[model samples]
Target: MSADDSVLLHTEGRAGYLTLNRPRALNALDHTMVRRIDEALTAWEHDPAVATVVLRGAGARGLCAGGDIRAIHRDASAGGGASSRAFWRDEYRLNDRIARYPKPYVALMDGIVMGGGVGLSAHAGVRIVTERSRIAMPETGIGFVPDVGGTFLLARAPGELGTHLALTGAAVGAADALLLGLADHFVPAARLSDLADGLAGAGVPETVARHAATAPGGELAAHREWIDSCYAADTVEEITERLADSGEQAAKEAAETLYTRSPTSLKVTLAALRRARALGSLEHALDQEYRIACAMLTSPDLVEGIRAQIIDKDRDPRWTPDRLAAVTAAEVARHFAPPAGPDLGLGAGGAAARDA
Candidate 1:
C-alpha cells in the first residue's frame, strides 16, 4: 500500500478515526506512518467539530507488530544511520504528543500490540484492550532498547513488574496490562465494533463505559511476590542470580529468556529503566531513548540481532561481547551520551527543540 493508504483516516460524527492499514505486515509502523498519524492529529486538534480521536489497526492479527526492523537492519548494515535516526526523531515526538493530546484520545488496543504498537496506544488518554490483546515492549530480543517513551511507562509500573517485563520481553494479556498500568479498560473483542460506533455520537466516557468489562485474572499479580523480590536487585547479574535461586518456575524461565537475549541490550535496558525512573517525565525518557537509539545504529548487535531474528531467520545472533561480564560499564554508559547530531531536545526544556 501507498503511504496514504498505510494509515486510513476518516471521521464519524464527533470522532476522528485513524486506522493502521498495513495488515500484511501487521501494520508495522514506519517513518511515513508516523508522519501521517501526526499530521492527522494536528488537523483534528484544531478542528472544533472533532470532539474525540480513536486509533485502531486494520487486521485480525494485531494493531501493530512494532517498527520496521527489516528497514533498520538494512540501514544499519549499510552504514546509513541518518534515515533511521530521522525516523526515531519524529516517532518519539509523536509519542510525546499522544501523551499530552487535548482531545480524548481513545486507543482500541485489540490485538498484538508490541514495541512501537505499545508506544502508539499506551500513552493515550483512554487505552482499551480485549481478550485478543497481547501487549509488550519486546525490543531487547532484537538487541535494541525500548524507545518511544516505553522506558518511561515501564519504569512507573508497580514494584519491579516493569523490570521483569523489560528483561523477559514478555507479552501480557489484558488483565496483566491493566495491572501494569499500560492500559485503562478491558472491552470484549466481540464488542469493539460497537464501541467504535458508539464513539461517533456519544462522549468518550459513556462510549467506553458501554463496553468496558472486568478483565479476567492476570498472571502477574500472582507472581508479584517473586517478581518484586527477584527484579529489585541493582544489577542484571544479581537479578539473574536471584531469579535462579528463587525456586519459582516462572522466575527461572525469565532467567533462561535473558540468557538468549543480547547481553549488551540487557545491560543497557536495565540502565535505561533505572534512569527513566529518575528522569520522571515522558519527554525526558524519550530524549534519553533517542540517544540510545542513535548509539544502537553503530552497535554490531542491532544489525546482527535483526539479521538472525528477521532477515536470516536463523534465531542465532552472535553478540559482539557475547557475555554479560564482558559488556563493561563504560560500554553501557556510552549509549547515554549525546548523539552526534542535534539532540531530540524534548526534555531539555518544556518545548521541543527539533521540529517534528
Candidate 2:
C-alpha cells in the first residue's frame, strides 16, 4: 500500500485517530509512516476540535511489529547505511514528540508490540494493552540495542526487571507490561472497539475507566526475586554467571536466552540501559540510542542477526565476536561515542547532552 494508506488518519468527534494500516506486514513502520504520523500530529495539535488523539493498528495481529527491518537489512548490507540512519533520525524524533505531546494521546497497544512498536505506544500519554498484547523491545535478538526511547523507559522499570527484559528480549503480557510501566490500562480485546468509540465523545479517563479491566496476572512479579538478584550484576557476563548459579530454572533459562543473542549486542545493550538510567530524560536517552544505532549499522552482527531472524530464518546468527568474553570494553564503549556527523540534538542544552 502507499504511505498514506499505510497510516489511515481521520477525525471522530473530539478524537483524532491514527490507524496503522498494514496488517499483512503486522503494521511494521517505515520512514514514511513515521513522517505521516508526525505530520498528522502537527496538524491536530492546534485544532481545537481535536481534544484527544487515539492510535491503533488496522490488523488483528498488532499495532506495529517494528520498523521495516527488511529495509534496514538491505541498507546495512549495501554498506553505506545512509538510508537506515536517516530513517532512525526521523523515527527517533517522532518518538520524542509522542512522549511530550500536548494532547491526551491514547495508544491502543493491543497484540504484538515490539521494538519500534514499543517506541510508538510506550511513550504516549495513555497506553492501553489487552489480553492479546505481547509487548517487548526485542532488539538484541536482532543484534540491535533498543532504540525509540526504549532504554529510557526500560531503565526506569523497577529494580532489575528492565535488565532482564532488555538482555533476553522477552515479550511480556498485559500485567507485566503494566508492572514495567509500559502500559497504563488493560482493556480486553473484545472491548477495544467500544473503548475507541467511547473515546469519540467522552474524556479519555472516563472512556478508559468504562472499558478498562484488571489485567491477567503476570509472571514477572513471581520471578522478581530471582530477576533482581541475578540481573543486578555490573556486566552481562556477570549477570549471566549469577543467573547460571542462581539455582532457579527461570534464571537458568534467562541466561540461556542471553547466550543466543549477539555477544556485542548483549554487552552494548547492557551499557546502554545502564547509561540511560543516568541520562535522566527521554531526549537524552534517544540521543544516545541514535549514536548506537548508527554505529550498529556498520556492525557485522546487525546484518547477521537480521539475516538469521528475518531473512534466512535459520535462527542462527554468527556474531563477529562469538562469545561474550570476546567482546571488549573498548568495543562496547565505542557505541557510546559521539557520532562522526551531527548528533541527534534532541537534548542539545542538557548536561547529559553536553557530556555526551
lDDT tens digits by residue: candidate 1, 295-346: 9998999998999999989999899888899999999999999999989999
lDDT of 1: 0.93
* Model 1: residues with Cα > 4 Å off, grouped in runs: 352-356
TM-score of each: 0.99, 0.97
Can you write out model 2's per-residue Cα lDDT over 1-356, one digit (the tens) per residue?
Answer: 66689999999899999999999999999999998999999999999999999999997899999999999999999848988988998898889889889999999999999999999999999999999999989999999998999999999999999999999999999999999999999999999999998999999999999999999999999999999999898988999999999999999999899989999999999999999999889999999999999899878999999999999999988999999999999999999998887888888755443333
- Report backbone clashes per prediction: 0, 0
Clashes of 1: 0
Cα shift from native, residue 179, model 2 (Å): 0.4
| Candidate 2: C-alpha RMSD after superposition | 2.3
**Global lDDT of each candidate:** 0.93, 0.93
What shift in Å separates residue 8 of candidate 2 from its native position after superposition?
0.1
